[model samples]
Target: MSICKIYFSLFLVSSFLTFLLSIYFLILDFSLIIELNLLEFNSSSLVMSILFDWISLLFMSFVLFISSMVIFYSEEYMAGDIYLSRFILLVVMFVFSMMLLIISPNLISILLGWDGLGLVSYCLVIYYQNAKSFNAGMLTALSNRIGDVALLMCIAWMMNYGSWNYIYYLEFMKFDWIMGLISYLVVLAALTKSAQIPFSAWLPAAMAAPTPVSALVHSSTLVTAGVYLLIRFNFSFSENLMILLLFISSLTMFMSGLGANFEFDLKKIIALSTLSQLGLMLSILSLGDYYLAFFHLLIHALFKALLFMCAGSIIHNLGNCQDIRFMGGLINQMPLTCSFFNICNFSLCGVPFFSGFYSKDLIVEVMSMGILNVYIYLVFYLSIGLTVCYSFRLSYYTMTGDFNYLGLNSLSEYSFIMLKGMGGLILFVIFSGSLLMWLVFPVPFFVCLPFFLKLMALLMVSLGIWLGYCMAKLKLNYNLSSLDYLTLSSFLGSMWNLPIISGLGVNYYPIYSGEIYTKIFDQGWTEYYGGQNLGKNLSKFSKFLQLLSNNHLKVYFMLMVGWIFFLVLNIY
Candidate 1:
């Protein structure tokens, strides 16, 4: 209790201060890079760079803010856990790492935070210490290591400029192949970290973590780190890379949204929604509307954290049951949590005047007006519908019906401490969109599109709400449409077989060949010709030497006979 209180106070105070500072910096249109030379050896200057731009400070504030809420919530949610202190420490470490990432513009410094996120996140994902958590943690870690390697390559690529501070060279890397290489590496790093497309399986898989950790990770810290990195380096992307990012992020957006609609796990549904939003951020960033992307990102952090918090509350009330299929009519029992959940869902669906609308509606308009092909346009809007489709489906399945899943007592709404933490952010989730929009952009983004194009956002949202209601309206006796088209449902539900692809498809051959190589080399021919054969030969030689040393009859006889035969042959 004392530890949680202490950290919560620290994070909360820091968040308020940084958020105020971000506002100050934004009004001044100012950015300051504080460079402390950690080491200056010859041509290489290793500097600990702290960037205090509006973006970094603002994002840092959000990270700290959400982290405080999560820690506060975990106090109640994780109340009886023996290692609560340890869990709190891991969360603090995660927030600290994210802060480090937020403030650093240097690639080397970023890696310190980048690698910290991977290591600490893996620890969080496996906090339960169960087989499922263990597997999720492994997948999360290995998948992120790919990004770690890519960031290392970015560092290496930046070495050509005689400095690791890539911020000083964003434009330089744009036209030149040397710098373009860094951009490619950065994109790859971001893709893996953000869980886009092929690397996406880890995001949902990481639901094995506690809900508080999920609130921190899937919302504000680890997943958004990639989006933040790309936001900083948005200027460096080449035309070809931008196009490719659009396609991949669009698909990731669609795939995750589709997966969520088919998913039954409450936490996984939220996780998948996060995946979809990440793709949205990346997609808009690719469209060269990074300000709006960052806006959506901040707004997303607010609600997604709350979404996970509410999900955690429900899951706790259900006695750790995460299936939405078993949940119904929770609104009467858990009215506050249900209200927060649906508000977040409405925000997620970009309902008018809500926090999500200010950012998301703007992004949709911008994308609609941007120079893009028909395929991208379609995927973009379809992903939006799928997002709402899943959110409403999740709401319907969990909140609309009776509390008959576990028992009446299991679904009580008495956890005020948890609700207290959630209350701190609920107002922000509702109004931060308009509030931040007014602050972040002095003059609004004016996009000129046709009447029908403007209607698309609403149309898709309405369609999604209708479809979600229809889908979740199924009775226990109703056969799931998902069950009818098992193959397609499985494909979509499994993230288009990405987990299998990134898991088995990626692992099978290397493991298979590794086993073969192990047998043929380490355990077979190499063993025969290297260590074992050498040992056998050495043993034989040692025995022969022992016979000579022992003055054995056969050894002595052979030696004496050979000496005599040599002497006789020399005389002849």
Candidate 2:
């Protein structure tokens, strides 16, 4: 009857439902036979399948398990928030939508579920309704819409080719221009959805939402949507555009990794790290190796979610302060939290004997197969190095620093329940390396290699940890405003402090010229950056439309004459 009891009941109900689905998925997983059905109904032929495939069921199982855990986590996590009822509703809706997305029979249903998930996530993002949260929600929703539009374009293209079904899309393997267009559109969709390249601006801004929102959206679900889409469309995607896709993925990984390097906000840095890692996943997806990519996705989701949740716990305990500069020596005050955070962070670095090690090695191993294009291999390797840079930066600064408590009077430890949840996830990240290797690829020799990728992973993690610790020892202030000034001074110099750089750089004489040419062309970069000023500048255009509105009688007479002219021409 109480609020907690009601939410607990709902969580239990959702967990039970997912458990049932997982059972069904497992049954399908063990069954070797895949039943394909070609049925004609309602004047349309439909090709559907009982997806008893190993990969689909495996991913479904992980999704169900993670959703259930998130439900449990939210039970305590969202207790303080006022909109608990609405939050629970959206959370349940998200789980339902994701279930539909993962198990949909056709592209249309998958898209429907994908769009639903996006909508619910937007609702979650704006749950606080503060100006900052609202702005974040709008940006997230808008960026996702860009991806949604790309997906729609791809769907339309596929429909025109009469291959709305993914299976059919794969079966028709002629690799035509239409297919290429669809592939490119899908990649664009993935890039935007996963917060890659230019579209990545929205994600770090998305940290304005609640901590749970960051955890759920960035770590486990929304950021992974694009990766999941790539996996779902694997057969179609892997055919011929692998090299081009590898190049783009490499660029995204590098750029986002650098962005994370420059960022100081804990959430923003992790957000960028998420983008970079997702780029790595996309790179693996480009290789057409579904098993490796999917496994990596699973491990990444587990540990990344754990890290985000730990970060949330830290922020919550510290009175909602998210800046790393204000946090230091938290391990002394909150040992359990620090330990769990470190476990997840180390897992993120792909330290040998961790789950990240196994999954990341798989991806790098596959990249090494690109003998002719060793450039891809180098990018992949460099991405791992960047991963170390950001991951260690996150760990040492927040968890193991010089007790830089920013005048906070009290610090509370994380709840036992939260620690228990984190501990479970940490265990997963610790041991799932061996579990996944044995389950997916049971080759003993391949699993047990020391002088190869494991050694590389260990060396990278150590070097990163040492370098980051040394950098932190120098007591570098992890403040963005300072870094911004430094960057502007170094990169922009005299242009840095200008009131309006573009405006100052422009030639005003062109605007002053007594010709209509300026009106036609010289709106300039200011118009793009400052749309309100652009509207003010374009008042003349508005006045012209106003004049048309004012002279409706003349406009009607002109329309009548035009109509008469058309009629006379037709008669002629």
Candidate 3:
């Protein structure tokens, strides 16, 4: 077997082992915390610790399982590449980094994993070695770097606690002023990592990566890291901070949903949907249900991974075309791929009995019961509706609509290896939510909601479907060129100009400042006074000294006599 295959099999075996271990921990309600002293000095020591509770174990198992499947999927998707082994190695390193992040309870050790994730993900993002990948990789790295720096500041603030293990200090430091600042910084880090609100541009741009990388990134490891961090640190947040987080997350959810509704790129649409789901997870976490957030995160990972894989299959068969406008009637041509795509889409929309329903329905009900502002309530519900809206729109544009491709296309289930990888996650997409709900929430949720509120989910979904169908059925010749419509479409289609804001708007000032610095300091003052001028003066002085040395003997004797006379005069 090839090395990739060998590694894939090994990871699959490990995932099974980890799953078994997680189940044991879950059933017994047992946790094991291990701390090893990596460095020791007077009154201080650098320590590494791992927390192996059911949460960590289960999360680790899911991450490993998904990673294994992605590796398998890439075997076919990434075939014919000369650096296939290197790609697999980088992926393995990514999995290892995620495991490190999952298990570590100490902030110091967590930085190792966190930085590893950023660095490795940058490598993966730029794997294709193209200008688009390069730009996207830079955006991805630099955006996540904000979180990295925030985490570093957090570590500095955490030094006041005499230990770097945050789990031990969350309660005691909750009310401390320093801890409050740390909490804010923690939220900032989480926001950036989760691609919430202003930090969301990078997520869509990162779709320049290969589809397998997109599946892994969007599903399990990179984006969910922030949610996992907040889950681990839920005890440290104050009510005011939670309120702030709630508002920001709600806005992010609404924004991404709105953006997804107008998006056309197949992968970017899914990427935006991932952003919206992340916003949902963060909002729930802010509402003080870390378990629900984690549940949704896990469930989202399953369906979203399958969704991306199916998209990849379609794109592969469509000769690398990702524009949904050029795709239509694929359901008749690729029935299996379309079926998987529809199932995943329905799961994403939270249709009853699907994996998303168990988590999403409960989330909406819980939010309804909570003491929240009307705007937040509206945004959440509308965002939910928009999810269905875009899903149906995407389905119409790509699946059941007229065949719009200009040339003959081969749409079939020829890539069985890719299908097998997707098949592994399809099973989980259908049942993981129910399974996780049973395992995580032994006590059921008590939801006392009114009829209208209870039916709100279904109502929005129905409305979304109707709107999507109407929009899709509109004639191609219909003119949408009016200023008002164009304005609204541009705003929504450009993700409310978030890409511009985060991409160009944020970088404009810094880049301008850098140019000014180069002109004033590097080329002007530094070059004149510190470099070129100094060198020029030194050269003149050296030339004068050489001239003096080349003087004739009479001139040298006269100079010696003058010096002797001056010395005698000084002595007198």
Candidate 4:
């Protein structure tokens, strides 16, 4: 069998096993939740509930299903590649780890599974091993490690107070400083893992990986880790802590929305949009609305995966060109691909009657319910507008306008296998939201509104597309810089180090203005502030460390001689 066939088979097996497991969990309706044992010798056994819950099991099923689809999609998407075997192995490993992590009952087990998942994701990101891809892989690894450490610390802190099981803590937990710390750390971990502000840079860089990898990363697993964590432990987050999470998440959502709007690279636009969606998820999670967040996650995964796959087809057909400037009139050449693209893009904008509309409306309703505060409502609506804007921008650039592709004749339709996968995903993206609406949270008006929202979003997206098309047709240059910057800044977060001061706090800011002034003026008789120059100051710090190391080496040599003398005396 071919490598592609092997990978496809592996994906099917993994997906089927996970689906069976989810069903098994659903079937085993456990009567008892907590079975704890305490003994005189001091060991305690706390067995929290493990049977499937409506929310968690539903999410687990989606993760399994989406992952399988992406894997199947990859069979065609990544065909003819040399590392097909390695890709298949790593992807299957990723699917396994993600599934295990989500279903684990205890925090310790979850962390262990999460660590493995993170490692596999990193491997997948750098699967190409090119310079840029490698960098993206390294950055993703570092960011995820930071998140893992925070989660570990939170778990350790919780264990100190005897709360290792996730389900038990949610029900029996009380608000305290340790709990607050854990909540904050967990939020941080979630934000980083989900590619929220400040930690979002790596995601755009991650576009350097293969399109299949992007489809996998965005839709099913990696970025969703933080969200899964948040929802899994919703009860433990507490009230005030949830409020804080809501604030941060809202801010992240607003920013990422703008950042995605301004991006030009097809993959990076999707990456930024994924970050925005994560922020939205975080915002909802903070409201203690786990159901809404999970549902939205499901919808987002289906549509986002569709978008990425569609983008992949376009790029593949166009000879690997990713910039929108080189793509135009692609609709004529690849009608099905364009159709799928439109479906996913419409879903992204949250058009009524679409899957995105239902999920997004639920989120909006959750915010309106105001489990946290009135401010959350504002953030939600603002994010809604921003979401519409960015989604429109994405659709406008790729699907609409004049045939400006430099080498027009070079373009061709995507391969048969690729079309098959894209077609399946497009169908899902179009129908999943509507299906889930009836299945999970049934409401007549709510279900109906999504169709309208989808239409409205489509109208807005069409307007943008038309404007872009006209510019191309007339050969009039419309600079997208302003839009691009809006997107870029939203995700960029304080242009390097500014946020360290503003967001984290002045006490922790690496570069202190007051310290520089003190060093310049407070030095004996020196009237000038040479310390104001950052370059010279860093050089001096480097020299100071060097001197300290030199003195330490001399002390080490004397200590070695003393050790030798003591040994000689003992021998005598």
Residue-pair clashes per prediction, in order, are: 2, 0, 0, 14
Q: Of models 2 and 4, which has the larger TM-score?
A: 2
TM-score of each: 0.92, 0.77, 0.91, 0.75
Question: Which stretches of model 4 miss by more than 4 angstroms?
Answer: 3-51, 161-163, 369-375, 442-572
Q: How many clashes in candidate 4?
A: 14
Give the Cα-based TM-score of candidate 3 against the true structure: 0.91
> What TM-score does prediction 1 earn?
0.92
Please write out the lDDT profile of model 4 over residues 206-311, one tens digit for every residue.
7887898788888878888889888876776777777677777777777766555545678877787787788888887776668778889989988998889889
Report model 4's TM-score to 2 decimal places. 0.75
Q: What tens-digit string does per-residue lDDT give for candidate 1 at 310-368?
A: 99998898889887878888898889999999999999999999899998889988988
Clashes by residue pair, model 3: none
User: Which run of 10 residues does model 3 get worst, by summed lDDT?
Assistant: 475-484
Candidate 2: tens digits of C-alpha lDDT, residues 1-572: 54544544565565456445545544455543243557878877755434445555556556555555555566677777777777767876776777666665466766787798789888888887898778677777877888888878877887876666665666475376777777778778887778766566667777876666677676556778788877766666645577777677777787776556545578877777787788888887787676677778888887887888888788878877877877888887888888888887778888778888888876776566444375776677777777787777777788765767666457767476666556656777788788877776645424444467546655666766676666556655444444355553222211122212222223355556735554444565644557756677689789999999999999999999999999999999
In terms of TM-score, which candidate is strongest?
1
Q: After superposing candidate 1, which stretches have Cα over 4 Å from the reference?
A: 37-46, 474-486, 515-572
Give candidate 4's root-mean-square deviation (CA, Å).
11.0
Error of 1 at 514 (Å): 4.0
lDDT of each: 0.89, 0.69, 0.88, 0.70
For 1-572, candidate 3 gives per-residue lDDT tens digits of: 98767877888888888888988998999989898888999998877899999888888888888888889999998897989999999999988999999999888778888899899999999988999899899999999999999999999999988888888888887888988998888888888889997898999999988899899999999999999999998898999999999988889899888877777789999999999999999899999999899999889999998899999999988889998888999988888889999999999999999999999999999999994889888998899899998899899999886789866666678899998998888889998889888888988899999899999999998988987777667623322223343477667767778777887788899999999999988898888988889999999999988887788776879989999999999999
